[model samples]
Target: MINGAHVILYSHDAEADRAFLRDVLGQPHVDAGGGWLIVKLPPAEIAVHPTDAAQAHELYFLCDDVEGTVRELTARGVEFTEPVTDAGWGLLTRLRLPGGGEVGLYEARHQRATDL
Candidate 1:
């Protein structure tokens, strides 16, 4: 039986990014060793989208209210690389991580697998 998923984010500035997630985003984490913080993610689900392009994996944080979440994060000094747009499946945005990586944030219109 599967217990959980661990996601790894490669960062140019690992220390800064860890601080961002721990302080700015207020994610609960524990130091793995020597200040390698492992942040705890919220409830998650996986999906497979058929694409003709190269195979890749994407991660997104789901929210109940995209607008409210955006406002909250913005006030916390988080920079959004993209404005919220209706992506058919959800209201979507991209927030820039301190490591120069962008991750998706969205409120899904489609049924969520997390409910299962």
Candidate 2:
């Protein structure tokens, strides 16, 4: 029986993604491999990175403020393909990673944070 899910994204630009996860998202991770650093994601942590493949995938991050999170990510030099906007479901924002993929950050007002 599966209780949780985790994903690993292969990248040629791992360092950049590593910095973005650690410095921007502030997720605690364990480092391994000298120049070949890999991050051990925290429980329930959702993360994204760049890829050369053409396949499309998505990752999500839960935030307190969608607007504030967008601002912070912008300031950090992360390019957002979609600005923060409110949909019927929740406040949503989309970002482009250096790995040629997209990640969505959402804040649901009607739903509890823990539920996400």
Task: Please tell me which predicted candidate would have the highest TM-score against the true structure.
Answer: 1
Model 2, runs deviating above 4 Å:
1-4, 35-57, 113-116
TM-score of each: 0.95, 0.68
Alpha-carbon local distance difference test for all models: 0.93, 0.71
lDDT of 1 by residue, 1-116 (tens): 99999999888988988999899888999998999899999889998899999999888999999999999999999999999999898999999989898889999999998888
State how far residue 88 of model 2 sits from its true place (Å).
Answer: 0.9
Output the lDDT of residue 54, model 1.
98
Instruction: Identify the leading candidate in terms of lDDT.
Output: 1
Runs off by more than 4 Å, candidate 1: none
**How many clashes would you count in candidate 1?**
0
